[model samples]
Target: MYSYKERSHIFNTLNSYAFDVLVIGGGITGAGIALDAASRGLSVALVEMQDFAAGTSSRSTKLVHGGLRYLKQFEVGLVADVGREREIVYENAVHVTKPEWMLLPIYKEGSLGSVTTSVALRLYDRLANVRKDERRKMLSKKETLDKVPFLKTEGLKGAGYYVEYKTDDARLTMEVIKKAVEYKAVCINYARVTDFVYKKKKIVAATVKDEISGDTITIHAHQIVNATGAWIEDVQALDQAQKKKQLRLTKGIHIVIDQSVLPLEQAVYFDTEDERMVFAIPRDGKTYVGTTDTFFEDDPINPTATSEDVEYLIEAINFIFPEQNVVAQHVESTWAGVRPLIYEDGKNPSEISRKDEIWTSKSGLMTIAGGKLTGYRKMAEEIVDKIVKKNRFKHATNCITQVLALSGAKGLNSKNFEDYIKNKAKVGESLGFSYEDAKALTAKYGTNVDDVFIHAKNHSADLNLPLALYAELSYSIEKEMAYTPSDFFIRRTGMLYFDIATVEQYKSAVVDLMSNTIGYSDTEKLIYQTQLDLFIDDAKNPK
Candidate 1:
């Protein structure tokens, strides 16, 4: 029932029933809360102003890493908590998360020397309770160069080798929300909460506007949670619950280049000349590197990579991989997102703590702000635990999400996923898919690839589109509730960023297919088309 066609029923359900919880945000945090609350037998509803994971949740560095650098900031607890949860997250969503060995190359003049990095990683391993097989390793300079031959060798001392989990952030949020829906949580995107309805200074309902239809409705709920990340203050002001402490937004950008340009075979987490850490990781024949953390005061809705940001990352790439001689032209695409850090006086954007804080307004609107992607489940558990203990919302149930497999992950574990995908690929090959394409689809969708293969089998011959694209679009529209071209290209398929050529090659066909399938009006089709064009242009040509 979690589809584009089911939105009317979702809205009706929201309006007719007084839910135990109404979560106003649909990023990973809100999705986590929805899943937690719903799994605990609470009737839950969630609303989002944009497509799911359209904000910071989608535009992360795409690592479920234990913040090793935070050890420098003395954030030991945060490091331990999010660090240990990495394996749990990997176990729960084996399809979206994978363990990547990260190399931290140490230089003569670098802030961290071999000894210090070794100590830090050891502390990190103990704190995170890393498994014996995946613990930290100290590599000699020769070994390190063998691992990543392109590294700068003039001042190289050694490197710290450790494990980090890579993830598709947007898909992770989607799977979490889909799992919540399976537990009967009514969630809708493109529904913006305009105002809160208060009775005797207690929030009882919210005035929400359907962004697509320009229609309004009031949803009744016993408890309302404000999980809007960067826009927390905006919603707080709407509730007239703006607090003294607020969000300090920071912008981070990443640049993607073909692997041929940089040819980085190993993932490197290295320090720039300015001593700030950056990551260069290879994915599907393209190596993506990023993330410049700087204060941003403009609109957080659509953060764009400035020329300065691109140049900074390019310089970092060249500084480490000097043989590559990478430049701006090598950049295929870029993405920028804002961090909704809780405001801290006199701290730089990077220095601000990543800890999450929960606050309740005078009208009882609970808001959560400032957390990492890896800590979402724990954050949700804490929030739900508070709600249950504080108000006795319903029959309290213990958190079961620790062992819960997300959508597409059922009956699959990290140990068995390789074999599962191999076996499933043969089945997909029998259904008009190439061996390689079948393997890729099986890997991406896990057990849910069965459903996607059905879509391919049923419609690929008739669609005049790539079988993979057709199947993905069909699955996204019917199961993932992708309503717009941007939702499909940017968040759902990630073609806009990782595989931009695929987007450019198939944009018109995709738009036409979506229009005919969903019956978009001519005006809506033009708007959606223009929106996708802007995204494509922005990815190619940064601000």
Candidate 2:
């Protein structure tokens, strides 16, 4: 597998090979395409402008489900398709994704009534092909309050409950990319495509510039795929392809608070006064509430949560969980993500369908746009199959990603993960990690826990880092290709969202470690530190 230190070798391999498919993006969609293509005996190379998952993939509501809200939009077909995909995502990456039973609290003047909510949930369960044990159920007012004590009781009729999977969206994307690498896909980050290398107006390769080294290389490939999520237009301009269809970006933000501040017992999806649904899901030792859908026209790469977005989320939380008394001060961290939904006529931001589309330009640059996280696998499969069928590439292997476990989920299934976690936690404890820390590490790394445990136990004393901290940092560097402190804090471990205090506590040591490990000069160290500081600032104190 490619490590962070193997940048030169990876670059050499990318430049030297004539790739069958060149993927231009490192988010989930691009990662999925790389994995699927490589697993089927295709030479694949992928490039990302920033760190992997630095864009919208890391900043999300972090749930994998068929869009239950789409039911309200009368997108029943989309709901059913992605509903089935939810299981495929969970089964493939069981460690990062887990079932979260969500409480849909019904109010008198809310978007859904009691009977209507129950009927909708039941239909949803059937359409999603939910297992019998995970089917929907109607809860009484008492049951609803019992599940979520902080929920407001006034105007509460009843609630419809269903299952949704919660996940670390960034980790999921990283793991997919790692699996792609394990299948021999040459992938590099901080490598941005500056221009297209065309042969007689047909895109034959791309000129990718290494953002870190300021060196450009031409990556020759028979086929090129543009899977840049929000920056779709930016890539399309390279090929000068624009037709009737276009991309409309919408921003969604989530705020994280320590669980001690407002302890939530259940994950609740409730309706705001404007009839838009928001989710308050609890994870680790934090409670996160999010996702406002409003049209946005700003820099897509680094979208920040505005005061208005934070205030709206807080107001929605207060409306649902009034007793919790959540305020702006209670917010610990925040993240804003933009959705690249395809432009639709006569549809508002919330009403835009999240179905993905594939367009092949006259220059043979295939572009995929407007998909949700849950449907990444199928979207990749569709694009690859189209390329294969159109004589762009020669491959006959069927899609086997349905059964391929992600990097950290080898030899595990949903039913046995708890036991696997317990068994691994003991091993971690024997290696001097506390029970809690051991369990957390085992859960994070899954089958890859042994390397982390060894690194944790054998960490250098010169660094003055904790056992778990050193382990995660070293494992991230040697195994996960984490190039910067922001990559470690934000995406690799998700400390920015769930444990902002940890990031604040260890930022200095982490920067020093990265500087020493990657042999960064003082100038490079300062630049990386500044980047991390800005991310911390954005998460802690939004605009």
Top lDDT model: 1
- Measured with C-alpha atoms, the lDDT of residue 416 in candidate 1 is 98
> What's model 1's TM-score?
0.99
Each prediction's TM-score against the native? 0.99, 0.98
Q: What C-alpha lDDT, on a 0 to 100 scale, does residue 15 get in candidate 1?
A: 82
* Candidate 2 RMSD computed on C-alpha atoms after optimal superposition onto the true structure: 1.2
- Relative to the unseen true structure, what is the C-alpha lDDT of residue 24 in candidate 1, on a scale of 0 to 100? 95
Query: Top TM-score: which candidate number?
Result: 1
Model 2 residue runs over 4 Å out of place are 240-244
Note the Cα lDDT for every prediction shown: 0.92, 0.89
Ten contiguous residues with the weakest lDDT in model 2: 238-247
Point out the worst 10-residue segment of candidate 1 by lDDT.
455-464
Candidate 2 residue lDDT tens string, 206-286: 998998889889999999999999988898888855332578999999999888977886898999988899998889878
Q: Which stretches of candidate 1 lie over 4 Å from their true place?
A: 460-462
**Predicted structure 2: lDDT:** 0.89
Model 1 scores what on Cα lDDT? 0.92
